[model samples]
Target chain A: MFYGYFNGTIAPTDQLAVGITDLGLLRGYGLFDYFLTYNGRPFQWDWYWARFQNSASRMHLKLPLGKDETYAIVMKLVERSNEAISKTGKATPTDVGIRFVLTGGYSADSISVEKPNLLILAEMIHPVPAIQYEQGIKVILDEYVREMAEVKSTDYKRVILMAEAIRAARASDILYQKGGEISELSRSNFFIVKGEKISTPDRHILHGITRKTVMQLAQSDFQVEERPVLLSELYDADEAFTTSSTKKILPITQIGELTIGDGHVGPKSKFLLERFDELVKTW
Target chain B: MFYGYFNGTIAPTDQLAVGITDLGLLRGYGLFDYFLTYNGRPFQWDWYWARFQNSASRMHLKLPLGKDETYAIVMKLVERSNEAISKTGKATPTDVGIRFVLTGGYSADSISVEKPNLLILAEMIHPVPAIQYEQGIKVILDEYVREMAEVKSTDYKRVILMAEAIRAARASDILYQKGGEISELSRSNFFIVKGEKISTPDRHILHGITRKTVMQLAQSDFQVEERPVLLSELYDADEAFTTSSTKKILPITQIGELTIGDGHVGPKSKFLLERFDELVKTW
Candidate 1:
């Protein structure tokens, strides 16, 4: 069951009462974040809303609610979604994902400083296959540039286009490259393993919720450094992987024709995968 | 009265439905286009849908409808939106805009080879303020390096964020620069005039619908060249203006702290504006 939030109610997904006139839909003028529910509760809820608020602030658009109040709105959506899913016998509380979208108000004859539109949605969670833990996945390299190296907006023309190449390469996903350096996958953070160390780009891409969790998860296993990753380093790495809110941890086995470190998922990837799922189950 | 197109008939915007697991919402995986409706009919409909088709094909996302069929869907949206407005006794047939959005479908486990989700939305059009064209408006500058410059995907974060600066800068819009050369504006195409020659960076930004219109409109009045527009040239131009589907032709009064070309609307900009509107009435 998908819950649509508009007019301060939990309506059916098809009954969404918004249109292109909503600034977010019109100009791609809104910001949103996706987070998963574990044990019927949302994880890292603060970071998700904070990013949305930060993005809205950057646009100078009027958010419908204040910080705490905004969180309250999302909580309302989560609750409504929980109730709807409960009515379904096939689903459980822990099997849901949530997305919160906040769009700047519709364009007026000139400009109106009115309140922005808010829509919070939820659905069943989709997790990548577990076999990727032992075998790793191949990734075709995306030879395009992301529209903005920074900021989060609704225009997904680049990322969605790259998802197919990921499947085509017989690879699990893609490593987004711009000017020969890797940026991100379709909607995930990328990491390269050098010996026992983990490195990633510093906030040049969307700061994924899972990527943050992985950094926290790695404190005990290896030191994680955030920096610009060079393309040359990808070829020499002992292991590589991409992280996102949905997939959690996806190991990259090959880049085009060349495979990384004997062309298989590395030992460190498995270790991180185990740690990731463990946190999901325990935390 | 916004008509949301699903599989078959025109439905209420609120009743419009998309699957919960659709890739469009999940991965931000989709391609879309917006067209300015002239009077009651969509202008340059072929160009608009062509770009959508091209973007979808490049990204390997399937379009739910072909060119002629998609065209019919948009026309349905326009007719319904105009009716909705006239019923309220607030809008005229001339006031309308069209948007077509197509997302990859909700297939389980994989997204590359799934059926697509499609929606067409239309609403009353809002023109720029009458004063904006006469006196022009100020603009801010920013940058974002995207992964895919050629394919149109839904990833729009950079300019959306920079729009905040535009608001604070007391400007109406934003233009982006790459490696010190002005690439394009957030929603409009950037241009700088030096005497009689008008120059702008091509292919770095969306070749805006109104932008192309102006290029044709300027054939007899001034030289329109597609090339890398330098920062120095922008700072020293005799006049500057931006073009888009929404704003039509807008002259720039200032960029950053520097006053543009006598710090007011220039003669050439006025000429182009008159020419553009002349074309719009018949466009």
Candidate 2:
């Protein structure tokens, strides 16, 4: 009973469909953003909206609706999703994960852009296992960089193709690097801590909202440096972690074959996750 | 009146709809191949099918139907397309461009793979004007390399985003390069002729079927080198051109600000195009 907003109508997500001639499908010319809700409320509405707009603008797509109108649509979908879930006999409504996909619309010529199609989807959130968050997760390193790194385009073929290799390596995700410089993960931002300082790559990577929040939270306790991080820095790093809408601050103890520090969850990431939880609880 | 085959059903292409949960639309996890029909028959069917299978294999997508079954489906769509086009009162039916799109099917979780969705489309062929072929088209050089360059995946966002710039520069397409070596164009394979020799990049390209045909045709008259072509060599080349399913053999007279050898179609490209036309006419 998950719900989604396609163009102008709200329908069952499973029934929502896009026409065959969409450039988004034929040419992969689209952008998307994902965010979470806290008690049925959008955790960081403004930041998500701004990033969505930035992605659209960077990709030369026109946003059909203004901020207020789009916000109204998201809220409506949120309400509908929770109501539908409650009907399943749950005593309490659960927080939902929201995703916004804006694509270069249906084109008579498959290569050209038409009116953009906007799909806002609401689905049940699946939290990462507590054990992974507590004990830390593993990541593999890949020698590649994403095209249009600043924009969240629907071009995840490399990551999708790496599924087998990731599983074979007993890794949960991949950290990308190009020309000896580490960039970011397939779907999240990477950070490494050394002594009391935190560092993350600033160039050729997505400017993640969660990464920004963690940096803001770390200002008082640790020194944060946003610059190009070298691949050589990972071998002896004291700690490492990744940030995303779903994985706020999942620790990374193992990278491919290298183990970070004592091969356990680090204190800085735990501290930042606690701070993030506190901030979101208030929201 | 255009028709398409989605999964197993044939319908008007405009009415063909893919589910919203498809990884093709959500994550761009798909591969595509397009070839033209000559006299209502697929030209070089074996080569095209082989390349499509290679792309699918590289992208980790499984084709739902085998070659014989898929050929039956394609022939059905082709017949339907011609029948519908003939209804428009034209005395003769037109040859159509056939495209095969294989996507990483619908997934409840947007990131995982499921049964692949196969879409076969038949559309009117739009040929480049003879004037452009005579005068030659201009292309701009881009300092980028495609991810999974050998696969025909649906990741054309960079090319789509460069549309405005291409128009501004009065260019027909983009030629991608990495680390000072020219690879290929946005939608075609690139080549340069020096004296009685022609060379095209052997790595980081889609290995276009048309490119193979042109190389084979030129073997009797010219030395064909399938190796990395340097960007520095482009400036002084005697002639340059591109090959694609639609364009076949279109000459290039300009590369960004440089006018290639007096800015007119070169004799080598003309000779090759004439050979290609003769070869196709016999089919």
What would the TM-scores of all predictions be? Answer: 0.79, 0.96
lDDT of each: 0.71, 0.90
lDDT by residue (B1-283, candidate 1, tens digit) is 6666766768766666555445554455665677777666678777777778888887677676788887777777777776776798875465467667776766564344368777776655667888988888987766554435444555454555565567778888777776787877766688888988988787677766677778888888778899888777866788998888887778888888878889888888888888877776875
Q: Which predicted model would earn the best DockQ?
A: 2
Q: How well is each residue in A28-73 modelled by candidate 2, as lDDT tens digits?
A: 8888999998876887889999999999999999999899998888
- Candidate 1 docking quality: incorrect, acceptable, medium or high: acceptable
What value does DockQ give for candidate 1?
Answer: 0.27
lDDT by residue (B186-233, candidate 2, tens digit) is: 999999999998999999999899999999999999999999999899
DockQ of candidate model 2:
0.77
lDDT at residue A177 of model 1 (Cα atoms): 78
lDDT at position B283, candidate 1: 59
Interface RMSD of each: 4.9, 0.9
